[model samples]
Structure formats: C-alpha cells, structure tokens
Target: MTTSRLARRLLRPPGVYAPQLDTRLLLGALRQEHLVGGAELLDVGTGTGALALSAARRGARVTALDVSHRAVLTARLNARRSRLRVRVLHGDMASLADLTWDLVVSNPPYVPSPRARVPARGPARAWDAGPDGRAVLDTVCDGAADALRPGGVLLLVHSALCGTDATLRKLEGSGLRAAVHRRAVAPYGPVLRSRLPWLRENGLVTDEQPGEELVVIRAVRV
Candidate 1:
C-alpha cells in the first residue's frame, strides 16, 4: 500500500482511539507474514480500522470489531472512503459469535491503571487496562483458539510492562504455539505520562525510565 494513499484514507473520530505507534507495530508484524488471497482476517478492538484496511489491501477478507460506537463508525467510514470491503462490527470479543478466522490481530487496551478493573466507559477505556495492564490482553489470549480456525494465526501488540511471558503462557495454555514476534522501545505517551505516579507507585516502572518496550506476540492455533 502506498503511504500517501493510506494516509489520505485513515480517519479517526474524536474520542475514538487513533492509529498510533502500536498500530504501526502490528502492521509491521502483519507485513512479515504472507497471507494468501481471501484469507479470513479479524482485527479485534479495531479502533480506527487501520489494521483492518491494511489487511484488506493485502487481499484478506477483513472483519473488524470494537466496543465503542464512535470507533465502529470511524472504521466503517474509513473503509467506505477507501472503497474497501470490510465488515466493521460494534462489539467486543465476547459478544462476537460463531465466527472463526484464518488470522487474528489485535492492539488491545494495555496501559496500566490504578483501578483493579478496566473502565467500562469513557475514552480511558481505549487504553486504561487495569492494575498490571493485562485486562483485555488476557481476554484476547484466552479466546485466541476459539477465534481462529485450526492452524490459524494471531498477532498482538502490547507494552512489555504487561509481561510478554504471561501472554505467551496464556496462549500456550489455550492450545496455541506462541512467541514474541517483534519489539520496539517507545517513549512514554500522554497516557503513560499521566499515569506515571500510579505506575511508579506500583513498581511497574522506574522513576527515571523514559520508555517502555512494545512487543508483538504471535500465536498459532494447533
């Protein structure tokens, strides 16, 4: 896909999660894998639909889902604006029924928050994963096998603070072979910087650290 072409098509509405470095990181992970034409792909927590469109550009039949109404609309708008055929659904993984995919990709809410549970509403829900930052990430791992067909793949991106080994174990426990697929250290974003006090208080990060390492975890259903 052409850079300018994608740039022109992506549209992020106010209050919806915008495409960010993690989005690009997952895109990079997807680029490394070779998906044949018509491969069924699902992008969980689709946000602005960036990954969904990217997969569509690669000839995959892409289906994207999100919990936010605004995000669902934004993704659908972008898909229509680009004239790409994408099925954008308004719901979360648990609400999605009886659909299996050849490949599943996600950039879930993973930033740590002081709260013990993920937010049910507000923009904070986009990134304020609870306590140890694995709220939604854990769910994704738990459902990977059910979401994919036999031998299908899953690509997920999240911060190192969330514990890569934890995700690997969850996926493996669910009958998928998993590994770290890619990694990049990124400076603290607005969300992380805002929660520095809680993060530091909980020993999630050091007082002087400037960044967190983002990792892409890839899993294959056996």
Candidate 2:
C-alpha cells in the first residue's frame, strides 16, 4: 500500500483533527529527509497517526502524541490496523520534555482565532490557536530544541497566516537552524471563511489576500 493510503485509511472521528493539506505537506518534507532505519521520531499533535505511520513505515521508531484522547485512540487503532508499531501518547508536547528524538515533526494548530484561549474541548481544539494563533505554535517552538537530540531535525508545517517569519525566528531563537523547506497555496477552508472579518481586523490578512499559504519548516539542532 502507498504511504498516502495509510493516512486515507485512518479513522477520524468528530473533534479529532483529520489529516489534511498541512499533514500532507509535512509528510512530503519527511520523505525528503530519508530517515535511517530505527531513527527515533516524534509526531507532535499527531492527528490520525498519518505522519507517525508514514515514518514508522520507513522503519523509524515513532511516537505519536496528541492532546485529545479520541485522537490518541484513533492513532493507536490506525497503527494496529496497518501493522505499524507506534508509541501513541495522549498529551501535549510539553508533557514529553524529558524525552529527545532523532527527528520531530508536527502539523500543529495555527489558525488565528477570536478567543484568547485555545479551546480545551470540541473540534476547535484541533485548529484554533487563540487570537494570535501562536498559543500552540509558540509552545512548540519553545520546546522543539529540547525535544530533539543534538544533530536531530524538526519538520513542522503550518499556515502562513500565523506568520512564517515569526515561526522561523522562534525556531532560530531556540538555537536551531531553520528555514522554509516547502510551500503550497490553498483556498480558505470553512474555518477560515467563517472568521474572515476577525482575521482581517487582526491584520493577519488583507483584502487582497486570496488564499492560505501553507509552509513546511525544517530545523536542525546542530
């Protein structure tokens, strides 16, 4: 079966983040790395075990982490169904600070929201990242350096609406060499369309902005 099929076949229930454009972008960047066998890897905010299963299929020792219990279960079930070994964990990235991996990847919540705090429950938890959209993004950047071993790599994918330069700066400030590895432009989804006014008022988007730009950021702990 193809690697993409692994994601397509996964079960995604309501409230769990489903594998989408950002997930596929990160997966492409991951494939570019050509990870060696048994390389320790972690997929932060792993929704549906797509990225985790992709890496595991390449023989990487993979651990998939999510804040949602339902997501965790879905990932576990997908792994079992695919006959892939993944250490699926139910928690945010901060919870696994003590552990370091050869590679870390995440397609985290990066949508700017009107709410000051990220949704603790419900489907919004999958994509809403507070007013600036950096609530989770910033946390991921702050913890990324610590989450990787020396010489390890980090592959992260998120929307350009949240600030690509901001993400690069955060990653660099954390002591990792970072840059945009790949990019793709896509039309606004339902979530973004629903809050167009809020996004515009916040200066995250201009009247001229046509669609969302997704980017894959690659960082290495040297």
How accurate locally, in lDDT, is each candidate?
0.88, 0.90
lDDT of 1 by residue, 25-144 (tens): 888889887899899999999998999988998899999999888899999999998889999998877777588999999999999888887888888989988899999999899888
Residue 172 in candidate 1 has what lDDT?
Answer: 94
List the lowest-lDDT window of 10 residues for candidate 1: 1-10
Best model number under lDDT? 2
Deviation (Å) of 185 in candidate 2: 0.7
TM-score to true structure, per model: 0.94, 0.96
Model 1 misses residue 119 by how many Å? 2.2
lDDT of 1: 0.88
Model 2, range 193-219, lDDT digits (tens) per residue?
999998888888888988999999999
* Predictions: Cα RMSD each: 1.9, 1.6
